[model samples]
Target chain A: MSHGRPVRRRGRPASAERNAGEPATRDRILGSARTEFAERGYDKASIRAIARGAGVDSALVHHYFGTKEQVFAAAVQGAFAPAMGIPDLLLSGDREEWGERLVGYIFKIWEDAVTRDPLLAIMRSAVSNETAAAIFRGLISRNLLERVSAGLDRPDAALRVELALAQLVGTAMLRYVIKVEPIASAPAEELIPRLAPVVQRHLTG
Target chain B: MSHGRPVRRRGRPASAERNAGEPATRDRILGSARTEFAERGYDKASIRAIARGAGVDSALVHHYFGTKEQVFAAAVQGAFAPAMGIPDLLLSGDREEWGERLVGYIFKIWEDAVTRDPLLAIMRSAVSNETAAAIFRGLISRNLLERVSAGLDRPDAALRVELALAQLVGTAMLRYVIKVEPIASAPAEELIPRLAPVVQRHLTG
Candidate 1:
């Protein structure tokens, strides 16, 4: 399958005659932006630098992603798209194992460098910038908490979901972001069993 | 309480002629560092700025606190002193009620402006800077987790303690820092009961 083209590439090279550029220029810009944002953070990150990193002109970066905020939005969308599937994951399977599955799925991502690095960058940016934090908040709330709550019949389901998430997010912040010992070095399998019940209790208890 | 002092001011100005400045100049520098670190984070925060914030010269700051790192160490000790009381609180309470007490104490600090503001600043700083994060991690591990684990009879106790903390810290990060809906707006009383069980399970289950 062709990549980086969220839109159909049906019309062959109609524009390619004029634009004879790489196939996934947008993806390249995205890749560069991710590196820039992760390294420099939102406030210090620059479009010029991102374009340079992507081996493109600054104008192209602007044309493709518009403002830095828009670029950040796109980056967030790409990074968090899989996490949006969390509600479905939580909804399926026995309700009894939802907590374990939820935590399990999260650690799976955290353990993988490709996914974890961008996430850590976003998390660090959010801590420093209100705009970044707002984006993080909106994504988590709309995609995960709200979706998960919709499946529950209870009134406090939203709060419960957040509490459960707090556990996971907090652990991630400590273990991954802060590199806190024990938790940081402990095997994920050991933690999964120990922490899953706490998550489960949040969901059902 | 003599404000800003970690030590007592005794002797009725025995050496007032030679050292007439306030008795707690050291404490004052520490207080200023906390504000600086919290507001600007570790990288951006400066010794001169912290000194100015405390109404002292840079030399005085250096004289009293040594390196910026030392200032941060002192600031951490001061800022985290209250939280260090957690083990005592956890140990004294009915083991079952420890969760409730733990959550209650945390919410008390998070809800209070005097404490919450500085703590929030420190947390935000810690998220972005490795030095700040290291200070935070060291304090939690040495003061809270290890101390609490010492009280526990069970194995994996340290991991359990970290998990319980993850729940509390994550909730605070989202509710107080990220300010997500429902959990952000929900009364602490409401959250405490719901979150207590999750913490309990991490500690005991």
Candidate 2:
């Protein structure tokens, strides 16, 4: 963490410079943290190392984020920031297409290069670290599951949302970690049409 | 970790009596490793402390497990041993009832005191550590998912099994981690009847 400043107005109090480093320094930490956490994971990603990566003091890292746990929360959130917008795309059309829309949106996010690494890092790290695990699970439940649930008309929409996300998550785990063939390298688009109906069932049926 | 000797072995392995204090020493180290991995998680659990807890040479641990990664794997497998039997159970009954049988078995395992601890430890720790995450994910795909697929009658049973397991895993995560409402404490028989059909659709639908 090479960069340094006394106070962090990090995107809070939108009217001030407090929002200053919120963008650059925060993004800097997030990017580096993404790589570091992915490479070494939570136990190895020390505050000092993250600080060094950001060209900022460790104190500044703490000032911006209250604790290591908070920093992790921010990192996981930033990693998924790109895909977090997918719900809007999903909710845009008729409810019938919702299944395709939701599944396609998720497959696209993992398929794309820019967002893939960070998400993989989050996925890899969260299952092993308690703090990161909590944040990662929460991010999925809140951002993906809860957001998707809001668009569904069914009573079990929330459970369905979780079930759908689970499909994506479980498939990703098999494809990436277990190195399962066929499923691993198969195109996301190919999987979407097949899985969407099931997701849709969870969502509307 | 403590009740020395492999569960299936009729007598202590030759190495057990070679050094009278060794089994106690090994078990202690394994126990400490489990707790450390659980609390600090995989990346954070230090060999130094694990050595102190075991009252043996830290070098001995490295000699046995090779690295932190190996240590984590050993600990998780030991902790998660109860679940490995899932594959066997799924394969035992009539194939048509595999889904219900599998779900009921998992619920029962979680309900029982003996099999519960290691699973809970693995579930929580798997989310936060990479190696543990990999181990957890691998154990599922290799040991659990393959078995589920073998007994399924549907063309997409592979995907469906993945889907069904996702719900179970997510539900387990919430039950163990967040302790979410009555869902966490619900009896196995009651919960299985409700959840098994969803799994049945995944297996044979």
Candidate 3:
């Protein structure tokens, strides 16, 4: 990939370049942003560095993502894209087994390197920076929790969904981020059966 | 609150000062370490800064806590001191209601700003830095999980203890650190009942 080289055509207007239908370029910038934020964290990451990592111009990054916070938001969104199907997954499964399916699905996503990396970056940023935390909070509340809770038939659906999530999120932090032993090294098969029932009780009990 | 001024006695040997049996000074250094680690994180926080914060000489910090990592470990131990009674609490309670007691105890700790602040610092450091994470993992595994698991009758007692912990830890991250909505605002009275059962099941089910 080109590194820090401006790819803009000399005769083309910056606005035209900005509007150009280049999904690949936009995706590349986002990938770079995830890396930058992951490595340097939110406070230290800059538009120039992200552009350099993506082999695009700094101006293009600004045009595509708007600002540092905006760039971080887009990165969080992109990172969460894979897991966005969760609500659908929750709705499709047998209601009694939703806990198993939910736990299984989350474990699958977290177990893979490709998906786990960006999510890890997003998590690290959220824990350390208030701006990043707010963006993450908004997305999770709107995109994930709201949809899942809406599908539930219970009265305290939102609270229940959040509790179910707390179980999963806490497991992920121990198993992945903190790498606490036993929990970290234990196989998913061993954990799912144990965890799913508790989750099921929270959702359907 | 002295800032940066050395409090070493003139001509006194550092070893003699180190062994002076001054519990108050040692506690003050630990408190300062927690604040520095919480504010600057593990990687950015310095021994010099920690000493300065405690209003003690740098030599005294080294004497009391051998290295920056050692200081962090001591600080983590101090922060965790309050929660150390948990294993005893678990052993003392009726086996079935251990979950309620556990959840109640933890929420009480996190709800209080005095106990919560240092823990938040430890968590932030653990998530962001590898060395800090290891220290935290070791401490949690040895001090909390092992003690609790030892009292359990199940063969997978260690894993069970960890899962129970994951539920509370995840809740803490969302409710306290991330401050996610609904979960963040939901009163402890409401959360305790819903969460206690899951925790109970994990421990005894």
Cα TM-score per model: 0.86, 0.73, 0.90
TM-score of chain B of each: 0.86, 0.79, 0.89
Model 1's CAPRI class is medium
Query: Poorest 10 consecutive residues of model 2 chain A by lDDT?
Result: A8-17
> Among these predicted structures, which one has the highest TM-score?
3
**Evaluated against the true chain A, what TM-score does chain A of model 3 have?**
0.89
Local error of candidate 2 at residue B24 (angstroms) = 7.3
List ranges where model 2 is wrong by over 4 Å. A1-22, A38-44, A59-67, A86-92, A123-150, A153-156, A177-182, B1-29, B43-48, B51-73, B112-114, B123-167, B177-195
Estimate every model's Cα lDDT from 0 to 1: 0.81, 0.68, 0.87
Q: Alpha-carbon error at B126 in model 3, in Å? A: 0.2
- Per-chain TM-score (chain B), model 1: 0.86
Q: How does the DockQ of candidate 3 come out?
A: 0.69
Cα deviation of B168, candidate 3, in Å: 0.5
lDDT of 3 by residue, B1-205 (tens): 4489467566435665557646788998998998887666678789999999999998989877899999999999989888898999999858988999998899889889999988988998888788999999999988988888889967888888889989998999899878998889999999999999899888888
- Residue B159 in model 2: lDDT: 67
